[model samples]
Structures are given as structure tokens and as C-alpha cells.
Target: LLADDGGHPAVRTGADRLTLTPVAELGLGLGEGGAALTVLPLIQSALLLASAAGPATVYTVDSQDVLADPDTIRA
Candidate 1:
């Protein structure tokens, strides 16, 4: 998964951090400029947890739908 803080200009991880730098030469197949990328830590965490458990399926719940009928989830 890719995530951006949308506020900070820096990308950081528990083990390492990277600062985006500009490409000196332009139009030299350099694609974009000063691109920022972030790899979500949750992916690694989920993989580790899933490996321990036999097998599992992941699902996303919509907030509005859940709010409309929270009791169904509880039951």
C-alpha cells in the first residue's frame, strides 16, 4: 500500500528514512520531479500476522453503512 502524510515532505520508517531529491538533467527520461513515495508498514504487519494464523480473508467496511446498523456487526 502507498500512503502520504499529506502534510509532511519527508518519508520515514522505523529502520530508515529517505529525502526526495531533484533530478539535475531535464527531459532525459527522468519521468517526474522530486517524487515522494511511501510504503505502508501495515502491509508487513498484516503479512506477519496472517502467516501465524492459518488463513484469512480481508474485508473493508464502509463507515456510513456500519453507522447505519452497528448492531449487526456486534451480533
Candidate 2:
């Protein structure tokens, strides 16, 4: 997942997957830690946000569904 961090399109593709897990999983944190990611309310959230402790948000996107769809991200 790439974010321009500016006012630009944020297109996503199923050609690949980007995942962020707990920081503790890296064996750096003594106890436990996470990336502390915050995401908007969108289908992409399904990839960036999920937990057995939260509301179920299941969504699947076809490879072409998001591929370079600037309009989808621009909105």
C-alpha cells in the first residue's frame, strides 16, 4: 500500500498485498506493540485493519477492481 501523503489518488491493486502486524512480532518490543495504524472507512480497510476483537469487516476486491483507479481513490 502506497500513500502519497498529499492530495493525490491512492489506488490499490490485488496484484500484491501489503500487511502490517504488531511491532512486538518483530521481537523488538519487550512485551507487545503494534504499528498503531489508523485508516479511513473504505474497502481497503479490510487489508489494513482487522482483529478478532472488533466488528467484522469483510470485503474482497478483484485485481482489476482497484488497479490504478484514480477516481476511486480521488474520491
Candidate 3:
């Protein structure tokens, strides 16, 4: 989103620590400067537990809506 929205991203763990990953530069910038872009994805659960200090304390849940009803999904 940094490429399209001009905002930063971050993550938080159960231990309450927050970490920021530096976004990779997209070759050149928005015509206002140099420019480029890229896509995004995921992270592993084990590493997330480690960041929380241990698995015993970490609880994770993921949810995705059915696309059959795009309007509901958007809502």
C-alpha cells in the first residue's frame, strides 16, 4: 500500500511489542519523483508465537468471507 497510498505498515505481538518493516523501494517514484511498485502476502505462525515470547501465550485467528456475495464481503 505504501506504493499506492503513501502510508507505512507495522505489526504487533502478544507481548505488546510493535515492529516496523521498511518497505522496499519501487524503482522510480510517483512522477512527483522517481517511480515503481510491487505486491504483498503473509508471515508464518511459529515466528509470530516466538515474537510473542512463546506459543502458550499466542492466539491467532484468520477469517475470509465468501466472494459469492461481493457486497457482503465488501461490507
Per residue, candidate 2 scores C-alpha lDDT tens digits across 1-75 of 322222112312321234422222222222221212222234245645664357755656555657857244321
* Order of quality (TM-score): 1, 3, 2
Model 1, residue 9: C-alpha shift (Å): 14
TM-score, every prediction: 0.25, 0.17, 0.18
Native-to-model Cα distance after best TM-score fit, residue 49 in candidate 1, in Å? 0.3
Model 2 lDDT-worst window of ten: 3-12
lDDT per residue as tens, model 3, 1-75 = 133222312212321242333244443324442222232322244456678885354433334434354334321
Model 2 alpha-carbon drift over 4 Å, by segment: 1-55, 68-75
Q: Please name the candidate that would achieve the greatest lDDT relative to the true structure.
A: 1
TM-score between model 2 and native = 0.17
Report lDDT (CA) for all predictions: 0.41, 0.33, 0.35
